[model samples]
Target: MQVKRFFAADMRQAMKLVRDELGADAAIIGNRRVAGGIELTAALDYPLQPAEPVKPNAALEAELRKTQAIIATAQARLSLPEGLTAKKDCQLFGERLDDFKNDFTGADHVANRVAEPAPEVVGPAPVAPHAYESASQDARGLDIVRSELHGLRELLETQLGSMAWSNMQQRQPNQAFLWRRLQRMGLPATVAHDLLAKVAGIAESQQAWRMLLAHFAQAVDVVRDDPMDEGGVIALVGPAGVGKTTTLSKLAARHVLQHGSQSIAIVSMDSFRIGAQEQLKTLGRILNVPIIPVGADQSLTQALAPLAQKKVVLIDTAGLPAADPAFRLQLEALASRGLRSKNYLALAATSQAQVLKAAWHSYKQCRLAGCVITKADEASTLGEVLGLAIGQRLPIAYFTDGPRIPDDLHRLRAHQLVSRAVSLQLAEEPSEDTMAAMFASFYNDLSRKVG
Candidate 1:
């Protein structure tokens, strides 16, 4: 866009020049009234310039004609402003319009009149000119009008109130005796309510402790972790005793049980763990699935070669807390290869929401696909767990109910997990003692010790 400035004796003449020269569709960037007339700035767009201007020829002439045509069209629309068009004749036209018949007449046909003065017809009787048009009384009467206006007002109010809940996400407070304490804390009600819901879920929200758990749980969001299903090399990675080995066995067992054992191979990253390979080997022996142990980075190339024919490559990684930088190093090695990768940040269901968040932070170095929750049967405050997952944007794929291999493991869904979490929260008089203990424990063990 390029701007062209035009100043003339008046705005109308300058605008006409703009249309005559620049063409129509030129955007008015700005206009201001000056002492004499007006100053106008306009913008126009044109095609890119050629390397150099062509001499007058058929092509150049054709371009000129097109440009001239566009300018002519623009000139036709440009006119003097309405204020400049005001003249005494314009005012007279409104008053003397057909002897005031059309000026303000409510009645169109003079003969078809009502005897009761026809509500002061403007054209025939010189109406007061202030009355506005309205529908005559109907069967529904004012009842319909009143109801419609009430609904319209309510709808408008609702739209404006939509913004009221913006700051209330902190979990709401309890509605009973707890409300006073909540007000004193100056906490937003939504957060208070959410915390109260968590209290309700755990049967733990008390007048005093309701806000605490709600705040904690609201701070967490647990997602139903789902691992990638794409065919390629897959690894189950997590900290020691987080059930990485068991999770591997469960997945491998399913593959072998569903497809034949010959179709799958298990590559263990933990060659150093005592009996880890042997334990997996034992499962392999029972399941009749082959287990490949990679001792070092180079060994993966050889191990992966024999399993090339396998439909799915399940790599059971060495279980190390992501706090260990070495775990990321091994993960990088797998990523170095063309193998598709996803790390399962396995978490124990009984783990505190704070601890789960810490575990997620520890595994932050790895590209975590989703979470695998274990030990869910031991805890009821799944809301805290779900909250943690949601806060981290981690999807949960599978949850292990216990030590059982295939029977205990099931993939989690978002709606199902939230529903279950809500149910647990809605359970009658959910306990708050557990929440109090957990909060105090963290404060004492972590904050106090560090401080």
Candidate 2:
């Protein structure tokens, strides 16, 4: 094999010279621009020996004939344009020659005149395909790539959205209601509706949930934040066994374990749940902190008032039925107490998105500083709850995974939450057994319905 470099102003000229020098099958290795000319590198192969010729069958002979005919037709058509140009030039040259020659002849004057030039007949150019079809196919391919890239972007965003952090807390005993009220006024529903529509596709749960998470993160990004660090006596409020009491206890323990128990005052706002007050009282005693026992809603103001010496006065609020009117009234007392509070709604990540939103709305007054994502270790899908929390703009203040008091509690991190959501999405995908069962159930239903 030998390689040669050719210089031409354009590809067509270069290719023509290449074909003239080497046979048509010569390989074009490379091409580039060099100064005033285009450079093309090509290689030609010469076999060492010819192989034994195979006998040509009838089909092969027919193909060869067709190929030769097509080549001949192209070559014939190719000659007509150059030939017409030549004929026009020859007629003009003869006319010029006649002007000189005609002066020399009085006889043969008719012969001296240039022969009348024949009218050139033009043939139609070979039909070429219109440009639109090629362009349309290219555009369609580009659209598919764009769609895939867009999908990947949405998936990544859904995995990265987390909540706003707050450093402020309320010191007044009844501030739990104030936090609830603040959270109610959070971002509008239109935010969720629009962003969710972007990532949500018409697919089954297993295939579509990642997109759901993506839009949910976008939805949460709309809620703005303010400084949440004021030391107000706010309480952890939620439904029973929602880990409110445990969450409250964790706060108290951390305050004591991090700062001396005496630095963080404990206020027991839960007079309803049996032994709820006792639980806080026991924790307070264990940490050697004062437990200000308050009974009625009005009593909260007085108990929280004496805790000014404490750095953070944490109120252990009772978890009531979310629908209780009395609990609403009690939570509303935070405003009357003139205290600022953040109502942290404790939520289990295993709950469905709809249920989580309901839980958020149920305490619609607690200005839910966001949420306390609890029992993260128990759920397979954090996206549902995280989507709910972000969708609500209620930043996670804490993430509690286990019963281990201080060790299990962590500040809400968006990346961690989204990563967990992605994992949960993968985990939630139906297994082979699940798919088979689903098909079996579907067939049974179809059979009954059809019959």
lDDT for each candidate structure = 0.54, 0.54
TM-scores of all predicted structures: 0.46, 0.47
lDDT of 1 at 136: 28
lDDT at position 414, candidate 1:
51
Give the lowest summed-lDDT range of ten residues in model 1.
Answer: 160-169
Report the C-alpha lDDT of model 1 over 1-451, residue by residue, as the tens digit. 8789888654445666789778997866656556765677788984445566423234323433443443343233222233321122122222222222221132212112321233444565553544222222221223333333333222222221221121111232233334333333322333344454444433333634644544544454344323334456777766677678887788887777676787777888886687788889899899988888886656566678878887777788776655677677776766553655666677876776557777788676567777777777766656555655655777677877777777777875555554455455423432242232222232223322333
- Cα distance off (Å), candidate 1, residue 393: 0.6
* lDDT for 188 (candidate 1): 31
Candidate 2: lDDT over CA atoms?
0.54
Point out where model 1 deviates above 4 Å.
1-229, 297-302, 321-325, 334-337, 422-451
**What residue runs in model 2 are displaced by over 4 Å at the alpha carbon?**
1-230, 335-337, 426-451
